[model samples]
Target: MIKEKAKKKWDLTRKMLEITDDEYNGVTQEDANLRFIKTKLQIAVYYLRMLDEHNCEYEVPWNKEQFKWLLRKPAGDTKKQKAKDWCHQCCLIRDKACASWSYEEATA
Candidate 1:
């Protein structure tokens, strides 16, 4: 049930990535892409959090290092730096979720 909900949210987010130019109004392409990336990160973190909540031991496809790299690479400009920081925050939250999952499993 949680997986299904996450999958639906993921699908909806992907669909949102296909919105038309007019849909963006005054937002630039770079900003739009950053928003998309942030949304994707949020979705990934949400699933990890859900996994922790359910005490699921399934492997997560992406690691904290990958998320850290994604968070740090695109920090060239102010806007990009904001996006990078946002990704970094997501990474921190995700790491906590995974760690909590591991701790719970170990203590169980």
Candidate 2:
């Protein structure tokens, strides 16, 4: 179930990024935004898959600092805040998935 959710998010983000790329007319801000989102989705998919396989030896794509940055407040703009909120939701899903794993055995 977690894998399927991650896959769906990745697929949707990829489609959005493609559309943004196709409509590119020298403006890069939108393209960059979508690219960032796509990257996050890709990482989520990877981590979720590894979790499904019970692979706990692998390191996370983002370190503690980077993940904290991803969830930080976006200055004072509503648009940026919305993006942060979406990222937080993604993190929650990944965190819940991680909690389902048996780390005790993996560490032993």
Candidate 3:
């Protein structure tokens, strides 16, 4: 059930992020905020995919060195840095959710 809910959330987020060229050209500040949200959702969906691929037992901590590359700040743009922070937080949330789901599955 938790997996199904995650899948549904991923699908909805993907749909929400699908904007056409015209829509992108007309983006307002609110649209930019939505894009930021979409970015976070995309990261969370990736975590969900990784968890599902490994049967919810994906060991992120074991691969910390490899994943640390994700936290590296880009050469410029504070906005990008902010986005990275948001993505990191999203990852943490998904990681906790993945662990909880794994425990639930193990006991079932």
Candidate 4:
């Protein structure tokens, strides 16, 4: 069951990458390419953090991509604060059951 849940989370992560890639349109294709790559790295970091909190055994490794993503600060202070808040929310919900879970888990 844990493996199945993990697979679904991974699939959702990949879908997010696809959505972001499709949404990317920058000054140059190279710029969009880099943004897309960085977004994927960010998603990977998000997923890894989730897995870590769950004590899940997975092969995803720490790399420079994740490091660069962490180092990047949004241009505007509001944007930076929003990003920080979002990460905090993700952390808060790590142990909680998904809203889409069956009623038993959802109600528990």
Among the numbered candidates, top TM-score falls to 3
Which digits, one per residue and each the tens of the lDDT, describe model 3 over residues 37-99?
446546755775556544554333323342333323231344445446656765775667665
Poorly placed runs, candidate 4 (over 4 Å): 1-25, 65-108
**After TM-score superposition, what is the CA distance of residue 45 in candidate 3 from its true location, in Å?**
1.0
Worst 10 residues of 3 by lDDT: 66-75
The segments of candidate 1 whose C-alpha lies over 4 angstroms from its true place after superposition are 18-76, 102-108
Query: Model 1 over residues 22-108: C-alpha lDDT tens digits?
Result: 534536665555555555566555655565454555455555565455444242355455444555665566666566543334463
Cα lDDT tens digits, model 2, 1-108, are 455654564464345434344434434565445445545544554554555455333334555465445433331243344444554555665676687666565564
Greater lDDT among 1 and 4 belongs to 1
Sorting all predicted structures by lDDT, with the top scorer first, yields 1, 3, 2, 4
Highest lDDT against the true fold, candidate: 1
Model 1 C-alpha lDDT versus the unseen true structure: 0.53
Q: Please, what is the TM-score per model?
A: 0.41, 0.37, 0.41, 0.36
| CA RMSD of all predictions | 10.7, 10.2, 10.8, 12.7
Q: Rate the local accuracy (lDDT) of all candidates.
A: 0.53, 0.49, 0.51, 0.48
The runs of at least 3 residues in candidate 3 whose Cα sits more than 4 Å from the true structure, single-residue gaps closed, are 1-13, 57-90, 93-108
Q: Across residues 1-108, which tens digit of lDDT does each residue of candidate 4 receive?
A: 365565665664445444343336556644444454555445545655566545545454434464445334332343344435444444445434343334345564
Q: Local error of candidate 3 at 74, Å?
A: 30
Q: Which stretches of candidate 2 lie over 4 Å from their true place?
A: 1-10, 19-76, 102-108
